[model samples]
Target: MSDPTRFIPVPTPETAHFWEGARAGELRLQRCADCRKAYFPPRAFCPECGSREVRVERASGRARLYSYVINHLPAPGFTAPYAIAVVELEEGPRMMSNILDCPQTPEALVLDMPLEVTFERLSDEISLPQFRPAKGRAA
Candidate 1:
């Protein structure tokens, strides 16, 4: 069942490819052709070089937990004691997402722990890219 009160993102021209890739079970990111720097939150230009020469590429779906906080406050469509995390992707970009399939605790979410991408479908056109403990990694 879907959460009626959960926030849903509307895809725009800049982010259309990202949403599409998520629905297809791929993590899409933007890279600066001029500087070869990978970036997230898809944009028309690269933040590093300020160049319009950017390209979209599929990510490896691998990352490491960089940081996180366990939220105990209540929020609509969310359970209490959930982890809000920032993960560093293998391709050298960092993104913020919720940690799933693991305990939302300081001990469970160690820094630099390996993670893998997973999708949470919110609608036909929207799927959130989240992360979980990688196979064989202690959760």
Candidate 2:
């Protein structure tokens, strides 16, 4: 038998809105009311000064490549040979995501590469955020 397909999530109530926005093709982050810092992963409080007051805002969906790892092994229900990357968003938060829409190769994955968010619909209600080269790249 198999372990079955596992859906990964935070299981928290406060971050629901952020996930919803992702499903709708929009990047969402929290803005600290006290310090005015935007952060990702949808937290309940600010990481800067521990302020509970915050608000959700739309992100520009643009980021620069920070780091990445090319996975040769399959991850659960996923296929082998994928790139898991951390992208530093234009809004000042770094988030973990997958790089897609191109050939996953050593020459293709470069550090500090400019990227833009594009949604891959996993299900009717779930859209996974993936990144590709911003534009004008030879495939």
Candidate 3:
């Protein structure tokens, strides 16, 4: 569980499954049945082929750090000097999340560093997926 001061996300009809998956300790993504492409920020239609033939699939929970910025300013539910990052999922989609459980430093947060998903439960209906450095992997 995160601090109560943290901003909680509300699940909409299109994103309910994603939240549910996080609650169950899974990272879920949508794939287009027509184009076979995976995408994030769950939507009803595929962004590539404009097809509604999409299915939700559990992701490998593996990713690599693509980009990030070390935040030095205070924010609700977050301490200063945290990394706000974008991770490229193994499924070929990218998602924004916070980097935790490691030193928040540039030298420590290398681009292309291996990462794995972890969840922080904010509520009964919301468990936010975050990432951390992969075990047994070097940056």
Candidate 4:
């Protein structure tokens, strides 16, 4: 198995701002100035209208649990039974992240549960955007 600890992302020029924002504890996304449509996996132009007038904006850090899977198999840099989830951001974008600070169980991970973004710094220059149960949710 590949070393998960070595699975660092190499940012391209198009995605540099997004990675930079994560390291700085902010969630950044791209919005097309033409269509006002926000999207992820940052690109040079808007995926909706093919407009180059895209701008970087900070996300609200709020999300809803869309779907998830509990991985029981051991992998590099991961413990068994970790929750890998797809979270729908408040701005209408969905991102895949690990659900932290909560048990990785079906009874604990409910669909549509509220979540908030938290950064996990991997290195001096790399920080991963992770999600955790929102404040006030049952523990």
Candidate 5:
């Protein structure tokens, strides 16, 4: 039997810092040195200002549930009834990730609710950044 957790990410030079930070238990993002705009999915230049001057920075690990769907379809490495969510980070960038530590339902996964980043080690070199209900929020 194959392990679903075997799914691993291959990091490119532009996104290496992000994958490294996740393995070290931190959420890393890039900020434009000129516009000071933070962004994700690691690009060589700033998406907002089209500047090549960008640097990696640690994020606050806080986010809000922007949108999501409860996926009930079967896949290679995922179970049915999983919540695939788009979360807006505190740094103003949005990321797509799986919502963890909560039931995959509308009543439990409230929109605009607070979320906290949690890393799941998928392999030796990859740790996916997932989110869970923030402390004191209804699950």
Candidate 6:
């Protein structure tokens, strides 16, 4: 596989705003003016109803750990024993982001576990959104 982070965004001109927001520690989703459906990985046209009018909407940064795997041996530039997860953002879009700030084990990274987004600065123009366990979990 290629550099995980590089392959992640796959940005286009239309998605620039969304990626920029992530770098700034904000979660942004695209909303269609016509159908009012929120979308992930911002696009020029709304995923629903095929509306051309869309706007960037800030998100609550809350998500659920939809699914994940603990990578014991990872690609170059990735540390071993990290959890890579598909987080279902509260906005209802599922994204591939790493799970950080938590134990990288099966027991600790369960499906449907509440999570929140955090950004790691990769470059001046780019950042990676990772998730961690949501607060108030039992010890």
Candidate 6 lDDT by residue in tens digits, 1-139: 2444554545679888887898789988888999988887778999879989988889999999898778887666687888777999998889988887777788888889888888877666678777888878611
Model 3 regions more than 4 Å off:
none
Question: Could you give candidate 5's per-residue lDDT for residues 13-54 as a string of tens digits?
Answer: 988989999999999999999999999889899999999999
How much lDDT does each candidate structure score? 0.92, 0.82, 0.93, 0.91, 0.91, 0.81
Candidate order by lDDT, decreasing, is: 3, 1, 5, 4, 2, 6
Q: lDDT tens digits, residues 32-102, model 2? A: 99999998778899988899999999998889889988899867866778888999999899998888876
Off by over 4 Å in 1: none
Off by over 4 Å in 5: 1-6
> By summed lDDT, which 10 consecutive residues of candidate 2 come out lowest?
1-10
Q: RMSD in angstroms, candidate 2?
A: 3.1
Candidate 3 TM-score, true structure as reference: 0.96
What are the runs in model 2 whose C-alpha is more than 4 Å off? 1-11, 137-139
Each model's backbone clash number? 0, 0, 0, 0, 0, 0
Candidate 1 per-residue lDDT, tens place, 68-91, comes to: 888999988899989889999999
Which of the two candidates, 2 or 4, achieves a greater TM-score against the reference? Answer: 4
Top lDDT prediction, candidate number = 3
Candidate 3, residue 138: the lDDT equals 45
Q: What is the lDDT of residue 50 in candidate 2?
A: 94
Screening candidate 1 with a backbone cut-off below 3 angstroms (N, C-alpha, C), the clashing residue pairs are: none
Name the weakest run of 10 consecutive residues (lDDT summed) in model 3: 1-10
Question: lDDT by residue for model 3 over 99-132, one digit each (tens)?
Answer: 8777899999999999999998898888999999
